[model samples]
Target: MSSNIRIIRICQQCGNEFEARKTTSKTCSDNCAKKAYKARQRSTNVQTSAEQTLQIKLKPIEDIKAQEFLTVNESAMLIRISRRSLYRLNERGELPFVKLNRRTVIRRSDIDRLFDRPAELMEKSRPEPVALADCYTMKEIREKYDISEKALYELIHRHEIPKQYSSIYAYVPKYRIDQLLSNPSNLS
Candidate 1:
């Protein structure tokens, strides 16, 4: 369509003002039009990338289950965590993967197997903490072992022995205390 109507319009890309012959004209000149077209293409490309990323994050595992092999990026997106975390798991020898070029692919089956042995991750049923009655008071540990309070405390700290503190006395497990302080000659 041709028109004699001249309208001042702002270029979408450069924001320059110029007279346009047609109402549909968005840019001032051929250069501005090219720039605007390129800008629009870039915007669409960005939007597409963002949409793909969201889709990857939101996609269900069932949808991806058919695939046997996945790249680090795909596996990370599938697991809904960062690639760094997956890499850490690999470093810790918890998550197994096939290295094709130093770092290549992870098996979907390996991931499934990792989750299958959930017991590895589950906390073992804690045996209830021994009652203070079953444990010797810290004073008793010091006196029985013929050690000073400071030495006894240092030993406990160094050995990472479990102990409980009450209002007046700290209690050490009987077995732990006996194991450390018991004399074999005395037993014999």
Candidate 2:
């Protein structure tokens, strides 16, 4: 029995028919290939134009609703912090909020106001730094504190310390460490 299977070809542009050496071939000639390419480009242009029109029509509705009251999670997302951190801020009288029944609500205007304030405002609002001679390395902190990296991470994760995201890991502020060291009661 013969092993070769028959192949079919269809012109992509003018719909002319011909035989092909392989099943994957779609055009009868280079002219048909160029024509098919042009047709594809035209379809892409039409799609992009339609999408732009739709976006233009919808943008005003989105803009008008942008300042609506936000949920705690939404406020957290907007501020790039966790919900727990936001709650902490609220508890500390740092973040303005409204208590709606059992739920906490924040206004978009308030969030914008919070962010619009200068960096000095936040610095002034934060707890005063404790005097410490040396900055502790992660290894030193782990060993001296008798805590694992995971435990240290837990403090940062819970927002007990001011932390910044480094390229590979989170770095705790030195003052936070000092505060923890100063408070013997916090050891557990």
Candidate 3:
């Protein structure tokens, strides 16, 4: 009878038991090593996917915080207006803004207030005190005179109306509008 022997080996790649022909064998075979490599790659892919999802979930919170206090550029983007137009409004005292160092800042609340009503309605809703004051918001101007935006701007451009700066809006002094209205020649 011929003598028989068996050798057991542990696959270096997968840690599974297998038969090996050589005492020096480490992996079960090249196939097992490749399978183990593929499994590791799959595990890495899952981990990367989970990390990506986590990042995506946190983006909105970060965006909100970023917008909480905004620079001129951010404010312009939020309002869907150009920076140049915003600057014009600032110069004309039509928008509320704060100056910090060399930068111009706008409050999120003020921007929110801008969209709260039609310009006409807002102009009309101001308290009598505000109406009589030196400055008013665009909305207030629209409401008080019952005029279109184009007409208001035309009045401002023609010096037919005098304006003052408040924290918001080019304030059309009620006195000036009254003076102009009293003089029908001022109407274009």
- Against the hidden reference, what TM-scores do the models get? 0.48, 0.33, 0.33
lDDT of 2 by residue, 69-179 (tens): 877866776666898888766644456677799777888887777678799987876755433333455666777777667556555445545433335443456666767
Error of 1 at 79 (Å): 4.7
- Which pairs clash (backbone N, Cα, C closer than 3 Å) in model 1? none
lDDT at residue 97 of model 2 (Cα atoms): 74
Clashing pairs in 3: 119-139, 123-139, 123-140, 135-171, 136-171
Estimate candidate 3's RMSD in Å: 16.3
Ranking by TM-score: 1, 2, 3
In order of lDDT, best first, we have 1, 3, 2
* Predicted candidate 1 versus true structure: per-residue lDDT over 1-188, tens digit per residue: 34655688887867889887778898888988898889889999999999998998777777777789888888887777898888656643457768787767999988777677657343342234788888998777767777777567656655556556577566778888798777543222
Global fold similarity of model 2 (TM-score): 0.33
Q: Pick the candidate with the highest TM-score.
A: 1
Model 1 sits at a Cα RMSD from the real structure of 14.3
* Candidate 2 residue pairs that clash: none
Model 2 gets an lDDT of: 0.66
Residue 158 CA displacement from its true place in model 1, Å: 36
